[model samples]
Target: MKENANSALKIVASFVFVFAIVGVLYVVYFNSNGQPSTDVPVGVKTFGSCSAMSSFIKTNAQKSYPSYWGSGVVRAFTGVTGAISASPSMAEGGKATDYSTTNIQVAGVDEADITKNDGKYIYTLSGDKVVIIDAYPAESAAVLSEIAFNSSTERVTEMFVNGDKLVLFGDKTDYNGPIMGAEISYRPYYYRTSSFVKIYDIVDRSNPILTRDVAIDGNYYSSRMIGDYVYVVLNSYVYEDIVMPNITAGGVETPVAGCADVQYFEDVVDSSYSLTTIMSINVNTEEMSEKVFLTGNTQTMYVSTDNIYLTSTQYYYEPMPLVGDFFPRSEEKTLIKRVGINGNTVEFKAEGSVPGWILNQFSMDEYNGNFRIATTSGHVSRSGGGSSNNVYVLNGSLDTIGTLEDLAPGEQIYSARFLGDRAYLVTFKKIDPLFAIDLSDPTNPNVLGKLKIPGYSSYLHPYDETHLIGIGKNAIEAEEGDFAWYQGVKLSLFDVSDVANPKEMSMVSIGERGTDSYALNDHKAFLFDKEKGLLVVPILLAEFDAEPQSDWDYGEYTFQGAYVYSVDLTSGFTYKGRITHVTDDSLLKSGYYYESPYSVKRSLYMDNTLYTISEKTVKANSLIDLSELANVSLPYEGSDYYYGYYGV
Candidate 1:
């Protein structure tokens, strides 16, 4: 009887122990929120080397929980291997090849002039290399011919076709010897430079000739042609000097400033220059002139029939000023100045100011008799971070028209466009959404509707008044150490005929997926062809599988390319075809051999050709004939450059 009783007691104790263990397991699993379970061994250090802990768990633990058993085993093995191969393998260079048999003609030009002329024209700065390609119905278009420029390395900064004259501006700067002696190379100095503006007579496209070149002290940033006068914005440098002195203590010497009676000194001045001028050139006589339009720090300018609008932002610098030292001052204000063009005098009568941040993004459109300015405050948050979507509207006189109500909490606007009686705003969050507002009444705007999507829509293009096109996607990172490139390019079409209820019609994914920066139509399509539509879009592709660096965080990663797509708004806004990267073998080889670190700069569809600018090359511009690639298929092979610097 005693032996049987002892055995029963032992069995009850075993049951109790098993029940306690089960309860503990249940609690842990419940706390994990349905995630796979992990072992927490007693007396074992959780924060120790992952590989060591993994090995311990594998050896000591009788069995892993069924839920996390696979992941736990894989992690343990991976940790050991990762520790052994802690150092990554060296990356290799990448090469891209043409997989298609189609031939795309290269116009042999780097950098074409982009102007919203009748259509767009690709003018090679090197020579009279002009290729007029059609942008309408992007497919089935051909290049007109190769037109040559008058000079080599003329470097056209701004060009506009005004009736019979092609008004152009060129900048050439040469640095004199060091402002200070080379022996005192650490010191800074300021030097003067010169630039010029030229006008060309292109009345006859076949026999275009340079009319005149006017010398100026500053480089021209932009220009506009009105009547016989060509208005130009010139940028010049303004220099200032700074000094610093060294102090010593005993004759043997202490280099402290407060220690010495007789001090040895060194003067260090920042000899940098700032932009400061606006000039006008008479197209008829080619004479250069100036106006008294004083600006603080201008970034952009726009001119209409009645007034000229100038956007300026205040620059901030560190190091507060001492009593007698020349320290930088903070101008806690942003200025939007409007000047009236009375005769030749630009009367700056109206101005407006905003607090804390400067103007970083803006869009201007004229409605009725009033000009509407949609401006966004710089990404300056109270927490000292960047946000892109705070939007404000201004009137023609630079007055605060109104501010758009913030659509989503913590969401900021990326872009705003005016279409007929309404305005479309693009905002960025986890995904992008289109907010439609009725602007028939400029003062009291109404949020008529909204549309949201999975990716980012950076730019919006409207076809007629009923249809809209959006270009957007999340950027992809290049490699382990490099930045994130663009990824998942999607083109979405929307029907906005009903302002209150906008609907998405269709979407198409092109290339490997990328981003679109700009798109336009040729003059023939813009003016005459209503039945057939032509649209040109510039697309920049992100490197495959590119991701952000582990340490740095500045969400900018993109690869450059130009894509021209044709849209038919009448038929569910269908995309016809695309013409991209149609160039000579030599040019393609050069582009492949020389990779640019910066994004693709600009693309313009003018006359009948497509012009593209490569930011990677010093003077990278290419002109391509659209007709050659109408039937060509783009190759989708992988890149050869493995970005990893593993072995080296």
Candidate 2:
């Protein structure tokens, strides 16, 4: 009986050994095939790297081997699964030029006007030069004779064309020499001595003669023409002169002479700089009329049929008070008012009373005959700044229609456009989600959908009701010797047919990293005819190179030509060529070049032309033919600064 029991035990032990051997073989085979093994379990470590080990063998030596076997196995499995789930490749297509060279001319380009007149001629303001281009046979869109102001220093601030008559508001600046003993080496303070509003008769496209030049007092900042009357906004003090006091050896304040009274314009002092007024001029009769006295600083004005909307922002300045010395306290407010143009009455008003500072710039779009205003407001603390966008839609009478809040958290709204029954708001921070709001019901609007991307978008234009062309920066990689430094602009095409689920079709980066705004012509073909459908992309190339970044200091850069592209709502979008620069030596060398006056930070697009305002030039506009200017290489050739990506 004992011998039989011993034999039974030996048989059981043999069975257990065979089972263990089989388990080991299975684990080895599973691992060899890039699959998870039961016996050899994979585990993640502190470094997030993976390691694998046999369950039966647990040893300190194995733990010290520094093997990433677990990670390798997971990666292998991921690769297999990804291969199985990959989508089919898109069909390859031929590349097409974005823009074709049609006509080139020397004119100051502003975003204010780029509308087609009589369906054949294109009117645009280029500094003191006003150009009318024929847009019929493509080649016919050449610049006719340009009207120039007699003085080389005089410049046109704003312009509008109504049928055959074109009205221009111009301002001239005279230097009062250097502020202090500093000669040409110092920045000169400019004083505007004269302002003029001129009207031109352009019945004949080739020869547009000036009809009247009405003198305007103060600085003519901006103007809009509706019917026979022209509404103008004027300001005597545009900028404040800030002077930081120097500390002496004995801890005494050393006042700098000729500093132009740094605190002269503060509200507490009630200085002359606080005064500004809005006026109206009759183009048909050539008569001047005062409309309203703008108490606060007015930045931009929009004129509709019955009302003129002005965005009024305030400014403040004060000296830092000593330990016990009285400190000057000042606060500024941003208010939007709809004033009656015919009767000169304040119709509607909405003011932001928060303690934080508000930017003077805002975007206005007309939807279903109602006006929509989108402005940014935020709180500024010592640690950081936070802001929110407030969109106010007003009725035809300038009454409040609706409000959309928190569209962008902490980002400023740059531009807004209405497409069909929806409005798209563009923001400054990263490629913001395009908030698609339904304006079908003007009073009670609904956020129908949103389009999100990975980069920043300043301006959005609709190719149709379903597709939008977002102009901004994508990603960029800088090459330094053998190494590469990468950044992104986030320039891309988005399919918004399903607004809720907008898909990023494709995105390409321009040369370096910078902000870009696009100007698109919508009447022409979406994909073909580069000369017909133009997309002007103005890249603030210099801002990418500035240091100690100042909110006000947009780098000094020229209007680096226009980048043209073609868009198709049904299929997709394509990068066309760029408008080639005028090759003629005379035109290239002419002093009448485009300079961006506004800080490079802001994107300006008016009509269908793009404008980049700079402080170096009196005229701040650049007119670009998108269809004909895309794919055209810029003349800049440097290492730190290169041409921005024209198209993606």
Candidate 3:
């Protein structure tokens, strides 16, 4: 994975000003009953009325976060579709019983992805529509049906297919009028953003029935599906007027949260406030439930089978008023709120504060009724700030029972994964240090061993109980600096059977600098079947005809497709074959490197057939030798193109 170098620069830039960028942006509201007369949960406070909620917003916006403003929005596409090639008669008669599922963190909990399969059929997004393809047997695959979305302002990010039901998660932005009473000469339009969930009955493959359409106020954060329930999280921006978000089901619209339904922690003093809303939907029955909380800013969220952990970054600024100028120093902390999950009943359980910021969802884990989190502290905004990493083990009540602090000074965490009784962490500055931490003792977590290597792994996956797979970038240390210049995508197999000594068993590098892969960032893009010794990664390969003159030199884009490898503990990664959706004519017309509409983004296997999917095509190949078997082209090819790392 590519390192984010701009973070250090942003911290340096913040020192020139007294008031830094406001972390909190919006308020999230959910439709619920009036506040209960009973006592609120511990560490939770409620407004209890509309007037009280409005008063809190006014006081915080004016006195505490006077410079708070809305943050920027991000927009991206998933996949599109084209047409099918082979006939239905060419397919084998029966459905495949052996198939692979999405790569998820926990066993029972499922994460939404762009592509999913049910052995016999494939479900994926194509432009603004959902395309269902009859994919099986490798010989014949055809487009079964396409469901086009009518809304232009909405984009479905991902979906989940359970049994005969298809649940789609989307984001919609509507022009909610203009901002009033602004100091500017012109009026700025305000767009109300919300997340929507649409559940469809796919009992009949050619035509899907829409059973539920739910629109919740706020921007979509992330979602998880477990068993019959789908949990969606959203973050809403709060305005001074205290415009509340509405929960619209079918057609009836209700205010998502009144003052009484809103809950907050009195201990967390954030510069601004955000209304974080979490909703649970029963996909089978179309029944929904929601809970809203006032948090610092919803950052990294980790959900297990029993609970959801939401984390937000909190900043403490110290003002230094000089005779003529002012400067402010700041420190960073993470506020974590744990919410219990039981069917549709979502309630706050505990709250904890840690000394740093988390990397992502993988930075935290839950096991044996305890929560473990890894974070990086120092060097956020302070001058001469040296970086350090730490891990905290919290019990059910969110109390820190064990801590291992200041493990790798001047280095930050690149990736982390928690297995059954051990935790693996990778930190990198000039070299990647893979640390094995013992977590069997919840009250005394400590590091057992460390392995220093030349590159870093941005993502880690447990191959089994004793082995692991790492996907990241290969780098070489710069001659004059305390850092390394990343070269290419690196895949490694690590043997961790020896809890006290971890070693890189085998490794391979692809392309050179400027090469990229979707699997490096999104774990869903990675396809691994340990039983079959198969691993597939969607990569955009870059290379050079001659040796580079400097360490900063990058390679040119040469190939774009999926790299198939047979990986194991003994032999490591062995190249099997490569699959590409780009045609030879298209590559030549665009100087040998064009972001083809058919750039493969994901891969899956059903029995012996491997399916490589992209925006415009889905091709099936033989799992043994990767020989082309069938080509299924989707109908709609929209104007938007995935430019890959080489942007448009």
Candidate 4:
């Protein structure tokens, strides 16, 4: 449901890279004859090597800033004092029946999350540390070690596993907190931020040796891993006016002085002191490469094997730009920039714009060579009350080629999924109305069919090529009010076999009024193995005896754990019951107040064994009957770092 969701591009197929380094001002030195204009076209500039890229950044640090940064930028730095090994960087897979990896959205693409398992070990995020478990041999599963952060400012939140190497990404904060008191030269005060990136080699089960560490002056944005290369995005708010940024490599603090070749885009963004940086590093390489571009906060990102898309949203108040009006005519638009990447090399390929903001990563998908996006425009705001939705298709160059807009008025997009040539969208106001769209013709898209259901699905997954499963809330069509009160968790199976008449073949819901599941929010919590017809989701349920006698009707914790089910196109959904780590009645007595983020945040399998993970325990169950096999009590369960999963 939540992630730091996050490339390189070639300018042209045959263009050879030239390192325009020290004293080389590519922005001003070259004139627009046969070369690029002062306002370069939206494309990438390649550095022949990592050293060249660093030199370019160091050389052009002054140009990296917009006109606004010179006067009002803020700067502050922190030091990490923990011991780090200086072993030489060494580089870098395996099996089917591996119970599938992480239920990724796309086949070859890997998304960073809190937990990652390669069928042998379960690497999960616990507070500020990563706990590695020998999960394969279920009965003998044990905690190998805990990888902790270097300082109080370091928080290891997300990670991605590439073969024998584990790349952990986190943010580095200053203990001093936000800069306070009077501002110098009339500039405002803001908090300083940075990023913490570390890679480790875990060939030996018990001890994981840290191979390399890279820290930069920016907050981590998002990341994706492909093959042995990892691409991470970092965003920095240049509050302090500094000539160069404070960066670190290995254990020594370094300066981004000689090679800060920051570049700018032709399109102007109003905000100042914003730098968007993308870093690409190979697991086997000792050196890391980075490209810094200028922009505002990167709101949404979509990454594929070949391209990385960074999108930002801006609100435009029209008709009243020059004059003051009580109710201004305003609208929101999202700007999308595409970059092509190969290993550590990144290039800007194309750029485009859509009407409104996207819901999540699933809202945008590339089919064949065409980029497809879905956005919702207009809303019932103080400015106006009309609402509209759209589906836009863009070509390789990011030129809007076709559009299908003005769909399901008053209802914004609740969930969307694109499969091959078709897209399924669910929009809700009072009820969920699922729309089926055809994208066979890029220039002219059409809505083939639609169906209305009681509730909306926040997340959608393909059950098969012809069917889909939606996870969301259950609701009764508002009995007396215009809106529905969400209750429990709803699962709907949709059959899109007939493009013209898609239907919800069947559905099932669990829990009571206050019940909730992590699957409804994060896609990572939802696990599905088509080969085994198995579906698992971590759910937290609260229930009452019946309708409340008073306005404040409180419910007690009914169940907490993962739910197992069997999904089939022919028979619909068959329940396999629940799996919980709560062992005694004493824990159950605690009830409603019971809060544990690790209380089954995720579930994974190695062949036939199903492992249910909680902060305090790890329990394996038989895949056939849902019977408990062997349970292992984990350490650090008392650590306050553990919080409720649904809080975020």
Candidate 5:
């Protein structure tokens, strides 16, 4: 989901780079051009030497901020806390079998997720540990091994399982809690966060051996695994003093990106700046490659087999004389930088810009050598004024070739999915408008059809070439504002066989006003199999017996589990059964209350048994009938930080 403009922070950084007092600004000066420019720089320039890099940074650092900088205040360093395709694999080189893999955008490329499996075993990150489960037969499923970290200041975010190798990514921060003295001492380096990657030889599942451990100075952004190569992205903030990001591997530390390795565009600059680094490691050979780009903070990343696209939102002010030009209008644009990847080698490819801001990584795609993107141009205010959606096609060189503008005016794009030559977009204000776009012409793309509905979908998944599955919320149009009041969690099946007339074949709504599902926003939480005609989503059902006080009144949490369904073209969605990790004891003690640790967050199926995973337990059930077969308790305990308290 996109962050609201009013709440989003504006970042500006100026740092003394390398061995000098000279400062460099990663931001572009607003005054350099009187108006926004469509003439985005084509290629990136490399800082050939430290002196050249220092000079470039120094020149940009001295540039003035945007005209609308005063609209938001800058607060510094408050040390406050905080799919249809199953890859058939052989277990131990045995007979080839079928098991569900990560639902990824690109076919060959794999995305990191909380849980991963390889036919016989399941690997998941439970709190601060990586639990490996022997999950072949449902009746005998059990936890095999676990790797734990320091629960005080370390966290494992996600991981990938490839054959005998298991790659894990996480963060380690220095600041555990706030100082408790009568007089608090604040330092610039009070909070230091570094992202780390660990590779383990899981050939011995019972005793996984750590082969390599590497740490880099930055916060984890995103990661992808392709074949034997895994790519990790990190964003490191540049402070007032010169402090280059470093990489520590095998007990030796080195600069992740030296002055010579850093690249930037002279024509692009924004308020937010960071050292965006992309690191590729060969899982088999343990070889690593790194490249750094000086740009605005990385917002959304789209990785294909050949390239990785990083997008960052850039804002510029336009003088509106009619509104007293003194208050400049903030205009948003997305800066896109593409880096080509071949095995373990990653190289800077091209750079470009789009007129509007993208919703997420799903808003961008690459097909048949052309790059496609969907964006929202103007800001949508409370009055629903002057906001429109757009789609732009860029060639291999990152130059605009085709344009589709002013789509669904007065509304913003809520969900987008690109399949082959067609794109599906959902935009909303008071109701949802699902647009079916034809991109076969590339240059003259137009809307083939549009379907208006009551609510909007935050995520769209392809059921097939001619169908789609949407998971979001049901809603009612408000009497006053241009927005709608969202209610129960909703699932809709769309048939797009007729490009000129798309239709919602069937739909289902769950719970009451405050119901939600993790699949709504996170695609990884969604599971579907065409062969088995199965669909699973983690749902948090909220319902109340008392009438709602108002449209905004929320319902009480009544259920937390995975909703299983049998979906088909003829019958739409058939509610199979639900699986819950919450024990009967907890349910009786708290009534309808929610237990954070028992909330099911992910679900996966292995052959005949389905696995529903929570922080506290992994429950296995029969795929035919939702009967519990086995349950394994996990070693995760809620911490003070998780309960909203600081270190105590």
Candidate 6:
């Protein structure tokens, strides 16, 4: 939540490769408009026609990239390529106690987050260190083990836990290597980085044994887990003529030793040095496989049960803007590639193109052999100029079947969610327009209903089949024509019981003028359980004496923590309370919202217990009365940890 280096590729036709060991193989194509090109059920397309792919690159890649970027764009997308989870946190164990897993997009696929649970113990990244808490007997909870990153760039960001093994993903800056027999003078100030994956065996609970240390060039783009395999994507730009990777499987291997292990697509050599390598590692067997895509720098990625979608934006260098325009002047197009994931193999599926760019992973969904996507088309412009939003329905081949284009003319998409046969879209300019779209028929998707509300939503999640929860900021119309000033964090519940008429059933705004929450930008921080009727979010509230004079005037910090709410399907929202790790009075008296420096960033439910975590503490509260039952403060002195060293 996250394979080996060798893979068996089964060519479906002449261009597509199906990675399935034993299953149905399909050869899909699209006509001029975007639909199935043929009706063939099985065939082979292993590496695609070299001549046709070259021609496609010549026609599309150059025009797709900006002249400034030069050779960064792909020559022929007419070629092949490769590239989340689809589920919620499931309570797997006993009825009296249920633990939460990572909230994912697909049921079987899991996405790595900051925190992970293995039923009995909860593993979380606290600053640059990881803390494993023995959180079973509510009253006897305590920190089990703590592991800190050894280097500055090795700051742990996310992790995944499966059985007795824990995999941690982090990034580190590149330091100057030894030259001749002596080390280089000093490292550059610029950020030259590498991504690291550390696999640890936590079977002993008290002492975690680091099993594998896999370091890859480039920064971490994204990752996913399906069954026993962990797939990680790293995007790197070639800088020096020589590159070395440090890998520790059986023993420590230098750049020279690991050099021979690096492989690339021989047919497409990336002149731009933009390299994207996807590595799949098996946690159970420790077998690893990698695939490299030249000039395939990923922007947004979506992973399904059987397929992966990689999206890249192509900047089209064009004529100058009219006098005073920056953003509205540029023209761009986005390309999507599909890759097959079977057991330990990842094979190229197909490729397609769309007009503009996508927002995030939430904007794409796979359901009933149809992939539905929402995109904000064109550059943002004054008046509706060329700006508009659209929704497209693509079949298994990724051909456009039905489309609702030029929607909400002047607005761009903020968030989108596709549930089963239904799709929900939120676009904002001055006011938020929540649209409920009916996708019962892929060939004819129409907006069933729309509700206009204040502010906008950045993330959308399903509460039930007919309910949705939105997390964003509350804003008020400003002096400008259609401008708004964003305020505190806003949590809204929408009732979509009637597809023809969706309504905001309950709306709640917390904090003061400049409050913010991690949930607004990161969906993983949001915790919602329908059966438990619980909603929890991390917030940093700020109070303003009056309307601020400028945007930077973030007001005075007041309170920082998590907000607990008992949400009812029909009754709306009921405020439970706020949980904070800060207990310093002198620091709180200084008008700082996050007095403890470390603030609560996430919350999850373990049966009837609610757990809130910060960089230095973990608190458990009863689900019924919200009373603190157990608390464990992490032991890491201020200057001991690279990240927590600041102690500000």
Q: What is the lDDT of candidate 6?
A: 0.67
Poorly placed runs, candidate 3 (over 4 Å):
1-39, 48-51, 61-65, 69-93, 184-189, 320-328, 380-385, 585-596, 640-648
- lDDT tens string, model 4, 1-648? 011111011111011111010111112111112122234443434334435543333343434322122233321111110000011122212221445466676666678887887777788876556888877667777788888765567888689877678888888876444345534343434456788788888888578888998888878988888888888888775454342345688678765422234444333333323456777878777457666655555667788888998776544433333244333454666678788878766767777787876777888898888889988886533233467788999998889999999988877888989888899999877789999999999999999999987889999899877899999987765455456667778999999999788899989987766777878878888888777778898877777777765423445667778999998887778999888876544443234222564468878887778888776667888889988777866664344322222221
TM-score (all chains, Cα) for each model: 0.56, 0.53, 0.88, 0.81, 0.86, 0.79
* lDDT values for all models: 0.40, 0.41, 0.75, 0.67, 0.75, 0.67
Best by lDDT: 3
Off by over 4 Å in 6: 1-96, 176-192, 239-248, 251-273, 321-328, 381-386, 544-555, 585-597, 638-648
Candidate 3 vs candidate 4, TM-score winner: 3
In terms of TM-score, the best-performing candidate is 3
Clashing pairs in 5: 24-57, 25-61, 28-269
Evaluated at residue 204, the lDDT of candidate 6 is: 85
Compute the lDDT for candidate 3. 0.75
The per-residue C-alpha lDDT of model 6 at residue 320 equals 46
TM-score of 3: 0.88
Give the lDDT of residue 492 in candidate 5. 95
Estimate, for each residue in 1-648, the C-alpha lDDT of model 2 and write its tens digit: 011224433343232211101000000111112232233213211111112111111122123111112211110000000000111222222111121211111011112332223334445444345556543334323455566664555777556666577887777565554456333232225454446667778778688877776554456666555556666666543222322222122323332111221111111111112223455656666555443231333555556555655554432324344345222233333345555556222222322221222232325655566776665664322222356666666776556768767656656665565665677676545335667777777777667777655555544545455766665544212222211222333455667778777766766565443323322221111112222344435332333454624322333333343344544543354565443233333332222233321212112232333322222111112233233321111112112111331111
Instruction: Score residue 528 of candidate 3 by CA lDDT.
Output: 89
Q: What is the lDDT of residue 90 in candidate 1?
A: 28
Backbone collision tally, model 2: 45
**180 in model 3: Cα distance from truth in Å?**
2.5
